[model samples]
Target: MSRHPDLQKFLDRYFMVFLAGYFLSLYAMAGTFSLVWSTYCRDCSREINYPLSLGVLVVTLVTAHAAVVRGRDWGVWMVAALCIGSVVFLLPTYGFRPHMGIFLSIIVVALLALLVLNSKRYRAMRVLLAEYRNKRQVERASKAQRPKVRRSR
Candidate 1:
């Protein structure tokens, strides 16, 4: 047997880690919003923004799936961009009254981003994914070039 690590297993574990971190950060954001909205924004007449939350969740999940399952680098970059965008956009929304939950979420996301960016295993998985794709392509090409053999009508 080859000594290389199993790519599927590694990806599965990585995805689990990503999910845990993502949900933790999401919980922090939700809790903070709940507390702040109740304390200060009760009279603002603003309802919870479900569309934005759903959009964020969908985008995050798709990018994570692409990165972990499809081994696409763009997915990783998208995740990073999302993280940075959240920090950039959210900080100013409070108008100099940032909550602890926002900070907590930011810190969690930052750590998650660091792990995604710095993991040697992820790098190795990318290489492996490329190699796997190349092998599949070669196999398809060779099969296409071969003459079809019909043994019996």
Candidate 2:
């Protein structure tokens, strides 16, 4: 289960991709939320910003895949933080105007669904799980190597 040292560099590459995707998703999600919020505030009806939101969500999902492939803890945390932020941002601000919150909620659902089904995340998770197991094995092995105390005569 021990990964080759050589693979660390490759892992770094995927992690970088994941971070890039994370930032991109943030920008896109914020932009889409803003766009919908702005348009609805001005027009007083649901506009067609779903496509733009979906596009950004798609990118974010793909980046989620990259993170899974790398098995990065920070990546998972980043995704979790994003989801939490979306929920926070999507909350209704005023009693009369709630379209923006609605729009954000819909996109959050879509993004969450995508994250659940993401294949890349699964692969990366596998690798990460293996790494954890390997580390555990090494710890056990080291413990076993320690000399036992002699019995008293």
Candidate 3:
């Protein structure tokens, strides 16, 4: 357990709120994109785009879960990159028009870059995760070094 239990609690609460908000925004953007695609490309074949979009969504969500729930720094970078890619893709598709999906994507990217990345709380969380990881490693090493005693049958 962290020495500052109250800070840990606050961090947990903040992450929970961030996770929920990010999930909802991402889901809404996906739905909006699907609707827009269907509306705009009625006669086009749906063989490639839908599956690609679904894959991206899945990857984004998984990385998000890892970053927020598991406290993995790599996950945070992956999500940030994906979100930036989303914004780029959205802007070209919308032709600079102000669409809700694009706005949501931009907001997500902004929040991640401005609020979450480089924040003191996030750094503290990373330190805590590192400590936990080190502790686990030590435990595993100790267990591996222990010799098993055999009993006579």
Candidate 4:
């Protein structure tokens, strides 16, 4: 029994969703900024357009939560990169000279990501979860089995 196999389908779907969300958000931000820049936001004002930033932050949080639930290193790093990039991009525009909030959020998010990715028990836990799920699948399959039929002479 492999925990990795057990969760593979779920992880795959989750990853697809996250990737889709990321790209969609990216395009949406481009469109929004273009529109804003053309019309009213040319002065580098209006708070650097934070709605998309907030959305990205929300998605990162969701990814981190999913990583915690699955104990997957891949998920953790993916989200960590997203968060770190966001902070780095915003820091300069936000006038963050030796900013405490910027540094603190990055550290907290990175540390949590590291803990999830490097946990000593994560692999074992995943294996156990897979084994348990496999057993349950087998039991359910057996319980749902149809009786074998014999051919008549």
Best by TM-score: 3
The whole-model lDDT of each prediction reads 0.58, 0.56, 0.60, 0.50
lDDT score, residue 83, model 1? 53
lDDT of 2 by residue, 4-57 (tens): 885686566455544444554565456546644664455654456555566766
Tens-place lDDT digits, model 3, residues 31-137 = 44654564455576679976786787787767665665465667656655555555555555454355666566655654555355456765666667656667778
| CA lDDT, candidate 4, residue 21 | 40
| lDDT for position 115 in model 4 | 49
lDDT tens readout by residue for model 1, 1-153: 643477567556555555654564454345444444544555665555545655666667566646644556676566555555555545544654557675656656655654655577555665666677778889999999999998996
Clashes of 2: 1
Name the lDDT value of residue 52 in candidate 3. Answer: 81
Regions of model 3 farther than 4 Å from truth: 1-14, 17-44, 47-49, 96-114
How many clashes in each structure? 0, 1, 0, 0
Higher-lDDT candidate of 1 and 4: 1
| Cα RMSDs, all models | 5.4, 11.5, 4.8, 11.3
Off by over 4 Å in 4: 1-49, 56-60, 67-98, 101-105, 143-153
* TM-score of candidate 1 versus the correct structure, residues matched by position: 0.59
Give the TM-scores of the predictions, in the order they appear: 0.59, 0.36, 0.63, 0.39
TM-score of 3: 0.63
Q: Highest lDDT among the candidates is held by which one?
A: 3
In candidate 4, list every pair of residues with a backbone clash. none
Per-residue lDDT of 119 in model 1? 72
